[model samples]
Target: MQRFDGRVALVTAAAQGIGAAVARRIAAEGGSVIVTDLQEDKVAELAAELGDRALAVRVDVTSRADLDAAVAAGVERFGRLDLLVNNAGACVVTAMPEDTTAEEWHRQLDLTLVSAAQSIQAALPHLLKTRGNVVTISSVNGLAAFGNLEYSAAKAGQLAMTQNFAARFGSSGVRFNVVAPGTIRTPNWDNQPDALDRLAKLYPLGRVGEPEDIAAAVAFLGSDDAAWITGHTLPVEGGVLTGPSALDLTPKGPFRKEQ
Candidate 1:
């Protein structure tokens, strides 16, 4: 709908899946997008697919230098950054508390939490100049307990960072918010059969969410329509946190009939 016309957006992990979907939506709405990811080839390919509206940059979110380079590239190409989507994140699919070594914990934290912080830090000055906004792709697990402890912890940290940035930059005209998706159907879910089933059951919608579902919320939050929305953790979880039905009197059942 051209909601982002004349704007510039920088989206991390934009090579595929949710990040790619977000980038595509922003571009479709007339926003110039910088697609960043560690997968250089994939990002380049997608950028090409998006044509001149997008620029591809290789960035390892955990590396300050990489993030700096990415921001610099965006400013160089687009002249200014109007929005930042911290969509880069990874999960630990096979580790429990006892099994999660320090290295593993740091790996998860660095990719999910610290990476976004670094990107924000690098892009803050440009964002300040433009009075831009930041949208972080956190998870529902950030607010409540979930199976992946390390991932949840990292996402919680991201949510906290979003609030801190929003409060700190509010006066400077920079807005920050978090979008917490429940169980989105992305490539990350490809081999996670157990996780898929569990999440599908937990969601009252009786199905997994789509990347566009999350992206649509992000697009709104990043637009002028959401100018008043900042420092909020918006859950796009399809009623997962609303608890089970009381009338059923059973621990589990199809919450609603499928349409």
Candidate 2:
């Protein structure tokens, strides 16, 4: 359980939801983490909650300066960096796809894909020394057709980026991987309670994912437990990738149990 003992990690967008869950999981496993997010006060609260093992820094992942400072602060506080969890992405496109402006597209990519790449660049030098790894939070939308076109594209970009980084730095003992999750009950879905309920029916597991669900996968990929793993996308979805009809159960699934 203490797989992260003596390790230090940097987690972006750690104020809430999946990000906070991942940070907590690492800290629970005896790792130190630098938690960053645009919500300064929220991150500060999270840092306080995690006590000495965590540090809170305000980071607008879209801002390279903030990203760099966050990385530096972690290294300064913890000595060395081992893992970078890129979880600072969102679905910002509100307009129709055809009507979406180039500026909006830029903003979307900059927030999701570019931020992840930038964080990697900032953490690479330190990761090299520790022979550490990165675990990016992508989405199933990247693997299949989802309504958020821009977000899906950015998520897909993460997969390719991880693979290339893994290949380029594999010899140096650096690893890169991604966790693609299905619908998770985050604060974003707080207002859409019915949406979550409806989405759950589509999942073979009978429920949408939780932030902790994704967090567990991140822990595995970031720790030495996955020393031989690299450049892979582990879908942390609850069997949704198999399609709801792909299974049989008393409920949640369409297929019935054999008599």
Candidate 3:
């Protein structure tokens, strides 16, 4: 039998990029998938392409109503919910910590942190009913500080939430875990030359990661193979976090310490 033959999955941000890849993979493994995004048209198109195995729903993850509705639609269509992938997120390229505007900060947090919270909250009942699992798409920035303050802060919040939720639901047979992807190549990478190069060099593998790479990790975590895993933050970073240090990349010098 296929690995996910009778499962139902709901993936956010499924119109494109990593979320889309994950949705496709789950469906390919025989799961019924609800592919949701704020971009209704693109999601609808992707859902259509996936045929009877997929359903498309328009959802703004930040909105509780939208998230609840999406979950309801999933249950109504698929008859049960077995997995929820909270993959919708956003980032802000700010000049400095102080320069980060309130609006930008809120937007980053709302999209990256609160959005996942809302989705998980809305899906909890159904997840509990099915003893389902949650696979959240966090970032390496959550574990270590990246220069993008807002993005890092929000992702950190997401990681914390993942752990807390896992602890809360673990006894009930619900599993929660995070897959933190480093420097993945997606449609969002266009026009960021400096970032792209820096990220590539940071990884021990010496190249940026691909969306499918992250998707594969998420798929594994959502499947029965990872049944014993929960509340863990797995880094799918191509050794970026474990690679050579900043000092190694710089010229050797007896650097002076500030008094």
Instruction: Report the number of clashing residue pairs per model.
Output: 0, 0, 0
Cα lDDT of model 1 by residue, 135-157, tens digit = 99999889998779999999999
> What is the C-alpha lDDT profile of model 2 across 1-259, one tens digit per residue?
5899999999999999999999999999999999999899999999999999999999999888888898898999999999999999999956888888898899999999999999999999999999989999999999988688888889999999999999999999999999999999999998877999888888988899999999999999998889999999999888888877443544674766698
Candidate 3 achieves a global lDDT of 0.90
Misplaced by over 4 Å in model 3 are 193-198, 245-259
Off by over 4 Å in 2: 246-259
**Which residue pairs does candidate 3 place in steric collision?**
none
Error of 3 at 35 (Å): 0.5
lDDT of 3 by residue, 159-210 (tens): 8999999999899999999999988888887877578778686677878888
Which candidate's TM-score is highest?
2
- lDDT values of the candidates? 0.90, 0.92, 0.90
| TM-score of every candidate | 0.91, 0.94, 0.91
Task: State candidate 1's TM-score.
Answer: 0.91
Answer with 2 or 3, whichever has the higher lDDT: 2
Ranking by TM-score: 2, 1, 3
